[model samples]
Target: MRRAPRIRLLLWHASAAIPVLGAAAAFYGPALERAGGAWPAPLDDVYIHFGFARAAALGHPFSWIPGNGYSSGGTSLTYPLALAPGYLLGFRGAWLGLFAALLACAALLDLCRSLRRLLEPRGGPGAASSRWVAWVAPLFVVAVPLLDWSWFSGMEVALLGAVLGRALVAVRRAELAPPARRPAEQLRAGLLAALLVATRPEAIALSAPLAVAVAHAAGSLGAAASLARASLPTALLLGAHAAANRAFTGEWSAAGAVRKLLLSNPYPTPLEKAVEVIKNLAALRVQALESALGGPWLSLVLPLLGAVAALDRRSRRVAVPLLLGAYGALLLVALNATARYQNLRYAAPSLVMLLVAAALGAHALARRGRLAAGVAAALAVAALAAPSAGFARQIDHFARASANIAGQHVEVARRLAARAPRPRRVLLGDAGAIPYLSGIPAIDGLGLGGYRGMPFARASVHGVPAVVELIERLDPAERPDVFALYPSWWGGLADVFGRRVDAVKIEDNVMCAADEKVIYEADWSALAPPGERRAGVIDEVDIADLMDERAHGYAFPSPRAGWVIGAVLPGGGDGAPRFDAGRLIPEGREQSFTVGAAAAFARGPAVLALRTDGGGPIALGVAALRDAGGEARVEVPERPAGRWSEIRVPLRDVAPGDRIRIRSLLGTFRSFHVWLLRP
Candidate 1:
């Protein structure tokens, strides 16, 4: 390859990568603008990477120990690895953006080079055919939807592609060389293979065939030596990382274990593990095949053609490594299939191999002559162009979503910062992105109240006493001033902080921002137990009694419209009735219930009141309550049947001062059940 052509190749590579770069910028650049100070979901990894890389740039060790101030222990190492180079270059967000662009460009360039090598050997008519194939190969590779999506994420797909491509080129070069000149060539091959291994752990599997190829090229004994030498650097790097992880987590394989836990736990039975592995493999196969075939049919066709081409004697060497990489990817996919996010990152190496195979197939077709080459080039270009178009649309959607999310995060961080006192611990339901954005020390909700020796063993040793001790040990000064709970975990916090003090700031559903610092001014002097602290719901509920009186009922009005009702009462006298539902129903609607004639209702006689939407006012009504020898019989009413209607039965009518269970057979009701108790 001459310098002029090489420069042209570089320029061509730049041109091919420009669209992807533009797409990434379109999707992620706006994210930076709207981020206020918060990062996006997939970018959680990126933010962690940024923190670690920033620390590294400032001459600090890249560790995940949070007490040290710049820890990424809870985060994956992918971001750190991807962002470290950019940070070292003194680049902030700009460097990250550029690094992403360059990795993509490198993938494109590798594709071009691989195509050129595969095509040139067929003794084509002129440079024009080779040039066409070279350019078209990358264009097709980039057009794959999977590759396009991978670019949007803060993953190293581009780098992975480059590494795999370089490994292939080195392998091909070593294989085709004379036997006498092979040893030195094999060393170079080993070095490239090592680089691949260092890029991603799964790359070892992806590059396995190439390792085998290098071994074969060197003869069995020489191959073993060559393989060991190639893997030495990777072994050392991983060994050091493992040692560090052991020091931190008390587990030599913490990195892998953490990754497994984060991705999917495979520690159950072998059958379960096998099922998970298969599912992931199937997904990767589908995605890879879909990308190669253009959309669906084309994806199948192109790969089949490539496979057919690989059947030729000259193509087997190339085919073997591609097959090995693909297999490795499938294995990884099976191991990590449940984790959709991680799957995308893990698929990078395999996609690189498929792109290589596709290029080779295109090259073989183009070998037939100008017209043949033109047709193949056109088909390849079309395959590439179509995905790029879809990828552009996805980038647009991702950009808008990311920007909106980022803006919301910034607002949340700013609000929390404003409300919180200095040096106060913030217990964030979602510690991710918030801590980095707000510049506050946040405690993990997952580790709240300390580990209590394993969940199952908490009651046997200390019971409520243990819980009380834990609460007492928790310093309010050290407790988070602002408790930010993501919508998913808001209920858990709500259980901890009672209603009067906990206020929800809802923009999105269930995402609540509560001020832990808010002190309620209650008339404690007038209480039955004067000066006694108010208890949370858990404290109020007598667990044994509550469990004993629990009744669950579910009704499906239609296939789509269904309702579930659950009631629990504390034992001894009548505890306050509680209702749990999948979703909250709006108030001021007629609610109906289907009471089976044979089924028992409330344990004791009860009073009921229909509370309003916000539990403000109560509507009083009546329902037939029969005492059936410890099994209460409640009959479905005729008036409120099949529609929304409210019926509240007083405690005096049923069992005096006892809680009753009621639910909507049809239509909506307020979020509460009938709580009949001594008032």
Candidate 2:
């Protein structure tokens, strides 16, 4: 009998730990295995902390770029500080995430036990009436995938939970302590209150009411002093931090709270927003809860009703639960009113409070005996099963999808780094995984990265992604070396820039150079490839200057045959290779050219040109980068007339090891620059 409660608590804890760890590993393992990627966080925002953590480890300490000084896009100001120690030691972030989960589970269990004890005095239909509240409530919550997923994500989520959990427990115990020790208890609670708000700006709203309630329960004599002590120190720290941020970056909130002011605010300009919230809440809230909790949204009501019923007799104050509920509701309202409504991440944190409430409710029902406990258990399982199963599927699916997308981004970043005049800058809309992987100083096209007050950040208000707009509007001096804006988020590549060359697509991300000459449609000629192969390759002779990739090693292979389009390179000018309005050439073997000196390889056939000499589009042979001064070679089966020539060169002629002595005659035209249409 002595071991029974311990055994039961262990089982409850196990229930929480096992499923969450399994789910996180399932979602995160593949990402960790891949280079330049992290375990896919439930929110891309988590990487903001990861970036800061990396910076802190490197001695730059919170700056994304080392030696560039401190700048952070992280929402949690202190979270990077917490992660610094783990990151400095060079532990894989995923393993650290597991450690955090364990700590969070321990805190959660403790919080539930405290709630069970606190609510025990309340009779009738309250959660503490049941003996199993401590165990069942924790089990229900941990089994839910959304809470676990967010908990293990590389953020300060678990730490915050632990802090809040301990504080709530302290608050409960202080109410029952003897009068002599009440003053000291109140002071200690005040310090915890201070720590809560000081740790996170968002925590202020959530922790404020709970602190007030705790002070009130401490009685009227020292209540004001306790609350004031908590508030003053927290205010001073926040003031100092904000002052420092303003000094450095000219912003009050380094988290970019002002950028999307309307969305972040619970109340927007129009009075109708309040009404809209009330009206639409009924329709959308249930769906949102279902999506986040991955189960019957009704299950949440169990805790809520229990909290209300337990509070009915005033045996114990359910302040923390109510405060958490209010915080979630307010956050939801703010997000719903703005365009920033996301995958319930903002609301999921509130679930921790609900779990406490459920424990109180479960205990009440269980106290009614075997029949009541059995009925409550049946209801709990039914409510939770679907969401659990659904979330599992979501984890698996996200892992698979992110691999394809993140892999492509990584490939592009590597290629750009190696390209001559190697670019040190990139700008993209998907700011997290790509920037982390793309071994370069990357800026958020949305201005969500430390460039908080910029025009792009303003334009992205209401969750509208405006990468192309920002790129187009930015001054020429501010233009990054590489641009990765998905056309779907903005507009088409051609419409935004007068012309874009080196059309590159990595998974969902699309990239192109502003001054690119030619781009190849990968699918125009693929081995039955998808339209996604249309992610173009740089092929054309660039109209502007770029240290071409060909001079490096991005070589395309030979093609079977070639056909003349509206225009071709070397436009019938023997003195120089002038690609005439109409010209054709044969596809050669491996896409390499043997010049007078070292060999140079072009990436692909220049299938499409950004600009045409005439009003219509022109075709140029793929451009080749070299050590400069290579004697050009133009090989066709038979040199044909300039206009309307049917040119067909066999692949056998340009076999490997056949060195074509290239001489650059001022007016000589060359054949298609490359054969294959891929890197």
Candidate 3:
């Protein structure tokens, strides 16, 4: 028994990985350039890791903003650790992640070869033939858009692939080796399993089953040795991790887990999430069958693999497939329970594993008859090239979309940094790319970047965040020098940071710039009361409350707050919009709603200020009435439709004894607050 030549093994791995890397560089390099040099990751969350890695390299563990308290916001410990060195080396994370991905791809290729040999040992028929699973399966996996993106996106997906592949291969080696060699193999498997847990906590489910399988196969003595070797180091590493967590954040689990699992979590219970995971698996099963390989290949590949997994006890390939089934089930359960997408990168390992199995099955079928072999070859081609058309389309769309959204985030941060008197602390829900670009600390209003005891609770709906109470709940020390909000007119944030600073509009958002010294004076006022809101509608009086609120896009403070009546010419934008519903909705006609005033006080010196889209005149028409027989019109000024216009009318001309009648207001109304002044 001789080992394969080292160069041949290297070539095998390199052949599998290089093409994919070349393609990604060719595609995204230009795509990102066209997107104004945005980061290649499809999600802003990817930047958060870059930020965390930088912080960790600076001696702060798991922080988006170093020098601030530790934030357990990072989901996986191993990814940032791997990524940190790149940040310290002063290079783009995409390169380092790609390096990791290349290695993972190589591991996947090795696993594919191992699978091939397991199904068709060297003595078998057509053993000399090209192993389609080894040569072709990787192409299919890399071509899948989501898998491609995940591997390249600077997250843990590629690392997971490499680590999981190592674990599987090592466990198989442990099972097959003689007792003398089994202990070391088992120990390697154990260490890899520990690394998986350290990489992503959810891998525990997958690791546990692999350990049992390896231990069972290795016999009691080998198993005992394996457990000792595995457990001692793993326990120490885990203990150190827990100690780090406790030392910095006073908790054993990352604060991110709580942020993701409890506060701001969506799924109510484990059972419900398990149900969703099961459904997603079924959908994936259907998705694979419907893919380019189509029903014919699935009909052949699935049943064959199922039969082999069930009956062929000696084959090592089935062992991984079985473990994959368990891993995916549990991983999906954890992912879905945490309210993440069940079909995306979170479950990608499982999908790629099946692709490996399917590849083997397809190749093995080719061994039967000439007709069978021809059919297998054609199906293999289709599976590799055809189903990927859909995935290619998806990647293209993702590239464009990620470019715009992620590009804006980076650009805004860059713009902010370019300004005079750079803000050191900023707050926003979309806080991912800002710190990465600006090199400034950030307070994540969304709690994604690691904040402790943020001012919100979990909501019933998945992905829906809770309503924030007031500024007092937010520590004054953590108060940002720059406060920003999306859809700027929302009352919640306005209420929280009201009149304390000047807010300007930037890219459809409100950015409040604070003074360098004394961000807020000791003379700061108590937090204002929230707006009066009920049943999805917040009227003029408490519109400020709605503006200042920090609530999710669902529920009362959500985007669902709206109404549509006859065409009174409605107008709204990112902030709260306002509408003047006519008596009835007409297909295409301008109309107005007359709002009545209850009482009038004698007017001496007064002021009337109204906010309107100025879409139509008479946004607010007020008149003086003194035994008036005819209606009095103020000859309200005309204004344009889109931009908000402040209409402040002075009453110095009014007779001291005259009373005023409140007339109608106008525009597409989301928020219209009218204030009356008297002096």
Say which candidate scores most in lDDT.
Answer: 3
Q: Could you estimate the TM-score for every candidate?
A: 0.60, 0.60, 0.63
User: On residues 1-679, what C-alpha lDDT tens digit does candidate 1 reach at each position?
Assistant: 4899779868766766665455555555655564444333334344444555555555654542133332324333444556667767755542454555555555556655655566555443534564566655556555565555565555556666666677777777787768777766776777777677555666667555676766765653476776764555556666876786545433454333333432323124557667766766666666555643356666654555457347645666676678667767657555653334432546656666766776676666666668877776766765555455455545554454444434444455556556634435555432344555566665544421112111111211112221222222334444344555543333423233323333334232211232222211111111112122222211111111111112222221221222222222222122333222222333222222323223334444343433322222333223433433332222333342222233444333343222233434333443323333322
List lDDT for all candidates, in order.
0.47, 0.46, 0.51
**Number of backbone collisions per candidate, in order?**
16, 26, 28
Q: Looking at candidate 3, what is the lDDT of residue 297?
A: 53
> Which residue ranges in model 3 land beyond 4 Å of their true spot?
1-14, 92-126, 129-132, 220-253, 261-311, 314-343, 360-379, 452-477, 487-491, 498-679
Each prediction's RMSD over C-alphas, in Å, is 13.3, 18.5, 14.4
- State the lDDT of candidate 3 residue by residue for 248-358, as single tens digits: 554566555545543224323546545665665555454443442344454344334434343434443434544465445444434443334412545555555555555
